[model samples]
Target: MLYKLNLEHILFLDIETVPESETFEQLDDVKQELWEHKTQYQRKDEFTAEEFYERAGIWAEFGKIICISVGYFTSKGDVRNFRVTTFHGAEAKLLKEFKNLLNSHFSKPNHLLCAHNGKEFDFPYIARRMVIHGINLPYKLDLFGKKPWEVPHLDTMELWKFGDYKHYTSLKLMANVLGIPSPKEDIDGSMVRDVYYNNGDLDRIIKYCELDVITTAQVFLRLRNEELLSDNEIVRI
Candidate 1:
């Protein structure tokens, strides 16, 4: 079935990131640094952390992730419904919990980790933060030396290109174009950092992350049906 791609081995994951600021004073320093960084980028001045944050777009403020959501899919008799799990907390705590969850759930080497832009963002961010927390990544995440297309990863964004490579489309935009209703339409990526930083609303972040996972899974199902398998068949999870 479309959902049965290596049934015992598929994990769809997404993350929500925010600017890091513990207090008002710290936020001021970060804002100053970010401002200087932006000025430098506009003037083509010397580059530094200050300038880097300013020009890095959404990656400014070090992108403190507040939520990590995962969805697991396996083939059942005529349908493909995925089970979703979420982890939310402080940046360090969430990283620790995410690594622990990965280790506990994916102890084996065969389980495949999937994400939309995971290769560029989700996967690397998780790996770096795991190392920061002195945690070892699960073996399934050992995608360092593999070629982009050869890796077990299934990036929906990459698949959407369909060999065109004209422009990079966001998950929300792709959902819109494909006529799929995105649960994330109300909470765009640009508001993610602010919502987490200002509101301290972890639930919002988790919901946002889950929406991305759902969209990614929907795209995956579409791709699988088109190129790999049909939807009516069944495979064990």
Candidate 2:
């Protein structure tokens, strides 16, 4: 049934994020205190608040989206292809670009936004960041009283769970188990913050981000028991 869904209507996406500040010391005094309080339960005495601050990208309140990469499938006869694109730079600009894309191209009842673990992370993270930036929420990302079935957002990770919530599986692990090539082979999520803040490598991050979107679409195909994309099928835009 999943494979029967229209591939062109699904916008596959992934995002890369980093702490709002280059360092914890850069946060305002009040924010510093709040960060300490917010992370207390997780950090405990294991590490200082400042030391644990590196992980702030996991929290939308403490981080900003640096890149959002999106991909979609198109077919002509038996030839299938994917086009990947990215929005990067200042958070506001990136958010606006993505919002515009959604409003202009994907704002339809039948279209969907898909990602790996997106419902919990990517989807909500993008929505929250848009709210923070004062940008309009794309219709696809806004839950707003819609029943679960009406939601256009699809999560590959959630599909793989099959109602078993206790077990957690990363995208890389899922890809490995499913025989899909891992996208994060060059740079994993753990290194994103440093690469962005310390090394100032937006190009590298954007490439990695796009790869994630491509891999996510591939994984979704795998879950649907469909054929995986070949290298020639992936076209970066």
Candidate 3:
């Protein structure tokens, strides 16, 4: 089904996260206990909390966002382009900057933030982290008391679910299904932590994050049955 929302007002984004500490042993005593409790249902007798720490990035309380890449559609005359940018470095610092951008440009009611599996992952993770960082949530990200349909967010994976709560689809899977070019190679989600902490390569991670943003936009376009943007049309801003 074609989404009634206007394309120009949508902001597509993706993020990469890693364990808060380089290793689970680095967590303080209190946090260590919390991690064990938080992950018990998932790890249960198979692995200790420390052993499962690599996956901490999946939880906002134990993980932190290292990169947030965003893309938005802009038009010049008859040409439409998707311009991209990244906010990365210290998680709090980058989050504040991203919040500022939202407050300045994308806080309008007409603006909506979209991401793959965002409602369950990216959106809530960002909100929790912002609260921890003492940053106020931008109107678009804040959902307090908002009706279900009133929330200014779009989730591509959720759209594909068609009300099947048990369904799960990766961005790569969605891109391949939609005939959009995949942006994966070199590294996948599992290797992001090693690439960041061990390899010291935020640049590489940023590139990966940027490609996800592009793919997300492309996936959204496909949902609307619109033509994919030619490579020349994706401008990195």
Any runs in candidate 1 off by more than 4 Å, and if so which? 1-4, 22-61, 75-79, 107-109, 145-150, 164-166, 226-237
Off by over 4 Å in 2: none
- lDDT scores of the candidates, listed in order: 0.65, 0.91, 0.91
lDDT tens per residue, model 3, 110-207: 88999999999999999999999999899988899999989999999998998999999999999998899876567888999999899999999999
| Collision count for each candidate, in order | 2, 0, 0
Worst 10 residues of 3 by lDDT: 1-10
Window of ten residues with lowest summed lDDT in model 2: 180-189
Better candidate by lDDT, 1 or 3: 3
lDDT of 1 by residue, 1-237 (tens): 345667547788998765455432455665766555555655464565543442233352344566788877655675655677788776678777777867788656566688887767887777766666676666656666767654666677877777876668887777677766556256767777556656867677677778677778777766665332223332222
> In order, what is each prediction's RMSD in angstroms?
5.5, 1.1, 1.2
State the number of backbone clashes in model 3. Answer: 0
Q: Considering only N, C-alpha and C atoms within 3 Å, which residue pairs clash in candidate 3?
A: none
Candidate 2 TM-score versus the reference: 0.97
